[model samples]
Target: MSQSIHTETSLPIEREVQAAIQGQRALAAYLATRFETQRIQIFDERNEAHQIELPTSALRLLVDILAELADGNAVRVVPVHAELTTQEAADLLNVSRPHLVKLLEAGELPFHRTGKHRRVRFADLMHYKGERDRSSEQALAELARQAQELGMGYE
Candidate 1:
């Protein structure tokens, strides 16, 4: 069995939606700053209140996720420590299972075998994806530069 865990949450509440729609700009401004707040308070339907404290970095990430949800974007939250099977990792990377297996076999991506199955860490997959994206961007930029130099007039 795979150790990966994925959670999908619904969009913000009505009040939150209204706030996001009306105050998106202000929200963006607030997020741009290094606001220092240690805890967040939640009020229940019974009018009871509770507080949860989090570190500054965690709060920042929470705010970022909330901002994205407020903007009507769906978000997937994956823990850094999660481990995914080959198929799950392949799906996340938008590649074929066979290709991912080949990558694993070639030692391009680090993985550990469980019996006959291979497991890849979510963090490692993300790191490899980032590097791959950066490399692709650089190659595209170089191609554009070459086209410009050759007066290809393809723009």
Candidate 2:
């Protein structure tokens, strides 16, 4: 069975969200420019201290995630081996449940049956998404080329 991925955050006002997004962007930029590994120290209210080290790549990913969250975006972190439900996969692809089912039925995307439900591997879904994006980009480029050739005022 596939597990649900929940990413819910509440920030009612737009101004607060904008401020958070700006702060995240600035922190991300600073982290990107910094060369040294980051060590984080946490102190509890009771004065207990804890320290942890973060690799640069992991820090970069954290920064990106933070920026997305700050921008009021719901982010879900799934392991590469995680299996997602049909609804979750559809949501990730920004398509309807029926459409995603159609793709699965057509073998356009791979999925496994969990009883009556379909479960898609996170890695497989990501691969499909990347391929779809690249295909769209290529098709758009081709259309632009054709438009340019026809003097349709397209750059």
Clashes of 2: 0
The sequence of per-residue lDDT tens digits that candidate 1 reaches over residues 42-142 is 79999899997656676557667667767876667777888999998999899999999999999999999889889999999999999999999999999
CA lDDT of every candidate:
0.80, 0.83
Model 2 Cα lDDT, one tens digit per residue, 54-115: 77677777677667767777566778998999998999999999999999999999999989
Q: In model 2, what are the clashing residue pairs, if there are any?
A: none
Per-candidate TM-scores read 0.74, 0.79
Worst 10 residues of 1 by lDDT: 24-33
| TM-score result, candidate 2 | 0.79
Candidate 1 TM-score versus the reference: 0.74
The best candidate in terms of lDDT: 2
